[model samples]
Target: MNINLLKLDFKNIRDFRELTIPLFKEKDVNTPFHISLIQMPNGTGKTTAINLLRSIVCGEILEKEIVLSYQPTRYKCDEGYFGVLLIIDRDLYSLGMHFDYRNGVMKYETSRPKEVGGGKSFSYDLPPYIRNVMTKNFTRLFVFDGEFSENILDNKKTEAETSIKFLYFLDRLELLKIKADTLLENKRKSTKDTKVHTQQGLTKLETEEKKLKQTLVDLNKQLKKFKEESVSTSQEIEDLEKKNDELLSENETIQAEFIEFTTKISSLENDIRNGTNIILNILRTPSQFSLKMNDKLKNLSENMSKLKLPRSVSSEFFKELSDEDECICGRPILNDSIKKKILEKAEQYLAADHITTTNCIKGSIRNMDDYKELSNLRDNLYSYINEKQQLIQAKDLLKLRLDEKDQEKAEKIKQEIIRLSSNLVDLNLYIQSLETKNSAFQEEFSLNEYENINLCQKKLIEKRKRLDEASDTVNFSNGVSLFKKMMDNIISSSIDKIKEDLISKSNTRISQLMGNKDVVLEKIEGCIYVDGKKGVSQGQSLAVAYAFLSTLFEDSPHKVPFIVDSPVGSLDLKVRREVSDLIPKLFAQLIVFIISSERNGFVEGIGKYEDVQFLTIYKDERETGSIAFHTDKKFFMQFHSENEEVQV
Candidate 1:
């Protein structure tokens, strides 16, 4: 598996957006490392660097490359909530933590810019259960532990509740069945929910002139029948409900067709690999403009090199010659005329040429390659703009056509009013039976009714909760907030339970890994804490964090690179030994940031690992950037030299 790095030049950052920008530029390393350790003293801007890398992996922001910027306030505080994203081989992803303060409200997004647009992208914003795959996918996220651990214990119940939905999400078949069941129940209940009232059917009135009109001939007979028997308004209301259902069904069918076509278009877009979009623009554009400009500049330089005249054109002799010469074409050429035409022209040409203008290449600056690249980028933006406009227009036109058809359909129903009224009554009683046949018309692929049904199920529960607390007074105030709170409770309860289980299990593993340490996890109002009452140093805290993090990568999907700034901060020999093994055990590539004094034993432990790599970063006298001292790891092949410090 090839590793992609998000490198920062450090000199170009202009703003906070740059911190959460992107880096896809890559370089080859001989190392088979899955982890890259970086050490930058407090002032080195490490946090700003990684966050920018995260935005690129997330793909939530930025267009193509990282734009060095610092104006976070200018983009609006809410805009800074975006994160950086970095992509790895296979389907691995890395996203930077994003935090933005807006007015009095603070917003935190789940994933950064680069990782967005996936159907799974929303998983980041969704409650915990929805974000499991993301949480579990990357192997090294486990290595990161901050004060947030305190929140986990503090909100165990809340965490568990959030985790429950994730449990359900994992069970796709169960979720599917639940969705179908909910839809079936909803359809069954709706049949009974509708009621209609009418004093009587339009009492068909017929005149003596009805006999002349065949259509009205039956009107009087129908009116006489209504007087003979009163039609039940309850049943008529039921018929109206059935008619409502039919209309709803038709609407659903139309929506389904639209969605099907939309999906087809999406598939087609992917198949073309963006060729359809840029093909026309690329074909129309030419790079000759740039090349021709370069040629003109070269010619100008050649002319300037040989532009000087002879040094011996004496004024006395030239004057005498001009006066003595006869003008064969017309008259004696005057000395003043000679000076006016030839000397003046030469003088102006020499004076007009500024040193800078003459010395500088007169060619247009854009190279052929630059023009080609810009042309392609411009075409892509233009095509997307044009395509979106077309789609919007088409959607509007389709809506208009559908509206027109709907009006026409309503009018058609008017002509058969009597017959429709009779038929609607029968449909009220027959809806349940007709709906049973829906299962028999299943398509080859599963229908997406589950999404609609799930929505209805949520709404139904909400309505039921309100109805239960329905006030006796007819003018009772609506309980929308109460219903919302109830829903929030249900959702919270489900996830909290799962979060609790994860923390508990993960902590259990951490304790086991610690072996003889007596560190306890603390609980607070909002966060879970790992505190060592018996003097826990900052270095110890980092080690504890590493221990806690290892459990997270037990069976991770992506073999991410593990990076530790200071792996054995304040640990004793024993803790370092365990950490040495743990880092390599958890990640495919391990990079340990050491302070030179802590190298021998740590390197020995990792040297046995298959693809481990290491390097030491220190100031160099000759090089502008930090020099890297390479070790045996293959990744540092570029920096490897016989001399210990090769100024690399």
Candidate 2:
């Protein structure tokens, strides 16, 4: 069965309106090129789309869980719905999940293949086989994000075991083996003629043994769960501690800036104070003192105009005028009396020595020009005072904002850091206690299980001995025991063979994808090995994970599409290319969800393929909804080649 259509109606889902994607088209079929690339920037509903698909797959076994799991802050009482439309045997069947939180339980329904004449019937019950195929276990194998990718790189033993079970359906074989064992035991119980009491005793011992074995399994499962929870909690604590340290560092930097701003504000205040004093002193004296100095200079100019002859002009010029027969104004001065009058007027002028002394005194007097200097000083002081006040105001405003805004914010972050640190301590202590408890439980369970098995074996031996002494024939019990042993051996050997084959195929895929790395992966007993050693680099581990997945799907009868988000984000440039090159060839229909940051390397690695489909998911500028549709390849190529920031 291959899924071709995924439709999402957000008439119900909060913050999301509608989404749909036709992953495959009938015409563009090409070998190893059935690639659908969706380039979504961060927060453009990429994770939401992934979750919707995950929920659709998980809805097979889970009821209300798929809907409740996506309860974001934006979620409201709205009807959200998702559908997975598949083509099974060239007939269309649609599986849908309708989630209405307001109504309580989510609804799951699917349609059978349409009748040849063209009618459809929808039912709540999915076919058992189809339901089994869409299990949550392999959901991670197909749909995964960065965290699971990192888990792959971690190469967890549990992850490997799950992969093996799903890859080859080993669990079904184990169930069959168990059924065969039960059948053989029932046959042994059916022997009627001889050793009836021994048979009853043996049956009772076997029942007790089965109960003890089941108890052991349950105990182991609980211990495994506890350990997993402890690991997860410890990781959370580590993350919180790291975040707390970062917050502390950020708070320190903000405080340092606050101090620097406070210093500047103080300096500005000092400058403003000094400027104010200087301007005040100038204002106190400018009006009255400037007027007096101007009035004195005006009086001195009038007195100088009144002065005659010797000081203002030379005495020799007056003597020349007296010697003249006529006055200088053309009046005749023939008589001595007229000449004497002119001479008397001239004589009233100061002597040359007095004139020189008067000029020297004028020069010595304080100049009124000092008022210009005083005026300029006053004006400059006022301007300086104004500028200083502006600077002070700016600094004070910034200080006010910092005190009102940044200080409170930083203080809140500091408090959060403290809270997170305390939580980390508590979480670590809880994890430690859980681990200790799990350890004790594991020890006790192992001892009890061992004792129970030993007792069961002894009781069986005694029953067999009694039957042998009471009668001559123990053939019926022996034959049944031998048949059960054969089934156990077959089951064990088959599991071993499956593991061996998976390891070999995984190695081949690793070589195909990363041959130049000179790394070999082997499964020794149940542990993974790298080049016959126990450890591998993160890149090698991720490569091995991809290799294992490729091998699993290659042999799987169900051709489920691979939908991976940011699968190659953690790899170096070289390994990213290697993995990208191997992706298209590995899966029949591959949907590669990638962000723009990783596009360049992926494009280079994917090289050129004509049949590749490209879809870009972005926010609708006019509406509060996400939109995704097939786009021109060159658009993304230009976006990457020009290194433009994607505005999604």
Best candidate per lDDT, number? 2
lDDT of 1 by residue, 529-586 (tens): 5676576544334444454344434433434445444456444565556556555654
TM-score each candidate.
Answer: 0.32, 0.48
Candidates in order have lDDT scores of: 0.41, 0.60
Task: Summarize candidate 2's per-residue lDDT along 1-648 as a digit string, tens digits.
Answer: 544433334434534566666665555421223787888767666687777777676564344665665443353445666676666545566667776665545676677754533334344444556567766777767887756655644534456655666656665656765676676556545544333434565565456556655654554555566556656655665665445334433454344554564466566567657766765665565433466755676567667756532266555556668889877788877888776777777776666788888776566443324443457656665665666566545433433334455556545644665675566566544434333434465465553333333433444555555455333223454655576677668766776777788788877777766555477766633335556254465556666666667777777777776788887774667667656776677776677888777776676767565557777765555654545444677766553412335332
Task: Output the TM-score of candidate 2.
Answer: 0.48
Instruction: Report residue 134 deviation for candidate 1 (angstroms).
Output: 7.6
TM-score of 1: 0.32
